[model samples]
Target: MILKRLILIAIVVLFSCSHTVKGQAPDAVKKTFQAKYPEENDPDWHKDDHGYYEANFKIDGIKYRADFNADGTWVETETSIDEDDLPDAIKKVIKEKFDDEKITEVEKVESATKGLFYDVEFKRKGKNKDVEFRADGTILN
Candidate 1:
């Protein structure tokens, strides 16, 4: 009897510790995510380090994730952007400066604090490098 009671207590503890952030998110968070991504549904939700919620979902064959607060406020969004989809100005800079480098991956980072920027990763002769650029094609770092 005592063993059964301990097992039941352990089950309760496991359930209580789980925040239940799975499958569907809260209504407020769903609304927030929907406002920006109208066509997306059933996002995989997880709690972020900053006490915000992150929703991971796919759109048009591209992977995207957006973060939000409990009150349905937008925190930030990161989308896997194709290298060819980069803005003309950014492409121009890469063509001129990194003629031989291969663009491995590009991300569109939109944040509330820092605003918008492109986080680009490129490869050259088995070496990888990362760069941050403003919308006007100025390299920030």
Candidate 2:
């Protein structure tokens, strides 16, 4: 009888602790992102199954997606450029340079890739041009 009672108490304690862990809110996740990526602005967060949060935001106009732990540290990030937001001139240049080239990736940067240019990665004529184009689609050095 005593063993059964002890087991029941243990089960109850474990259940309560699990509930507390699962009940953590989205704000906690937000706080975690803020603490880690201090310069990030206006992040969007939502809950997902398996008791965790996901966040989406832009850094330097480049979109990024991040997943956080229940306690709010980053798990991983997927970063990319929003091609639709690219300027028309740049798009035109991309189309003209490689007629058969299909853009695989685009990124906007200020310094790393030299100025605010689009680092477009594409394949054409069986060759790949990971070319950088200005906002106006002018190829950069």
Candidate 3:
């Protein structure tokens, strides 16, 4: 009886865990993603908190994450980037405004609504902050 109970519990756990990951993206989302990323064949799909289908893939050794709506509209794409790769305009803003904060991470973002921007995460005195900047040095947030 104990062995049977253990096996049942294991099966329940496995099914629950798999259920979370196995929610396949909609056909529209997959079609749009394929059109956008022709070279990447396989992408790990996940539904974000906002109900957007996110595709995590790699291109030329660089990792990328793209979000698409259920209706097949592309939302955004983001990729980690080095600080030195930032535009001079953005660098100037960081130097001028965020000089006191230590840079933690940077990502280049291309959004359907917001166009293109850089997301710069900073750590200051045990607190974390994120700043978004356009390529021309305009701050969005």
Candidate 4:
């Protein structure tokens, strides 16, 4: 009986200490993003296969990807804006406003058809802001 009780206690402790595979808390991910890209904000963060965090955003109508380590440091980034996929107006506006800001993450929201846009995230002027722009480049609050 004592052996069984001890085994049960060990199992409970192990499970309690384990990190959930779903990912860490949202704030933790946000803090990590902010630390790595101080100029960007409101990134859509998700856990990738390697158990690291991945963020998506757009800058100047260009899609960008940023991968973070478990501790939230930047692992890698890719910047490639597909003009054919993005509306020309949005492309133009982004180019005009955020020439220096780097696009870090993007998400295609399906809630509204006509207003469909890439939720662009960027680092600019030592601050971070979430900019929602229509495919046609209309900024939405």
Candidate 5:
């Protein structure tokens, strides 16, 4: 009897998770997202155990991610950016500090805790370097 009960519980848990991932979010969540970013098309959705939804999509050939809470509230967005898209302050720092290093990738991060920042990755020879900088070119790491 105990074994049967355990199997039933397992099945229920699995069923909930089955609809929680891979472009599957509640109608309400989708509605909220649609209203917010009407221009975004065909966003891939994912749900977490803690009632968070994440959307991964691209805009203008640049990749972006937007997260929402269970209530469909926008959490934050992270967008992949090009070296040319970086701000003048950031460009200045990179040019002065890492002139020889090649910028491999850059990301623009926007969050509640840490407003906005740039995550830049540089490559020198075979080694890779990661650094975060504030909008005004203050290197955090």
Candidate 6:
């Protein structure tokens, strides 16, 4: 009985300590997000690993995720895109190098520090790998 009670308590604590908390973002963060995405009335907010606020919202039927600093500074925004929508330069690289791997996900990332890039996720032999590339087909990572 004691062990079961301990397990229950642990489960409760773990759930309560989850990083993502809906509608708990600070006012500054929300305001920043609002200014950037005026059309989105409400965006589900979560705390990221870097302590930044992450807002998940949709625009024009496309899902987007935007990050903001505590003091309302815009950090980055990312949106998923179809594989065929990728730039031709990026497509050529994928065809030459990553053809063997299955494309799992793709995102167009615009970062304040890193500028614009594409993030492509690939799965091979049960392992997933993410690679960042510039629009001109230059690999960032």
lDDT for predicted candidate 6 compared with the true structure: 0.92
Compared to the true structure, candidate 5 yields what TM-score?
0.62
The prediction achieving the highest TM-score against the true structure is 6
CA lDDT, every model vs. true structure: 0.84, 0.67, 0.89, 0.65, 0.82, 0.92
RMSD of 5: 7.2
lDDT by residue (41-69, candidate 3, tens digit) is 88988777787888888999999999989
TM-score of each: 0.62, 0.42, 0.82, 0.37, 0.62, 0.86
Cα lDDT tens digits, model 5, 1-141, are 999999999999888884446557767768887887798858988765556788888777778887787777777788988789889999999989998887888999887567899999987666788898998999987
Superior candidate under TM-score, 3 versus 4 = 3
Cα RMSD of all models vs. native, in order, equals 7.2, 12.6, 4.7, 16.0, 7.2, 2.2
Clashing pairs in 6: none
Off by over 4 Å in 1: 1-20, 24-26, 49-51, 95-103, 122-130
Better model by TM-score: candidate 1 vs candidate 4 = 1
Q: Candidate 3 has which clashing residue pairs, if any? A: none
Instruction: List, residue by residue over 35-67, the lDDT tens digit for candidate 2.
Output: 868998576665555555666678777687666
Candidate 1 residue 58 Cα shift, in angstroms, is 2.4
What overall lDDT, based on C-alpha atoms, would model 2 receive against the true structure?
A: 0.67
Sort all candidates by lDDT, best to worst. 6, 3, 1, 5, 2, 4
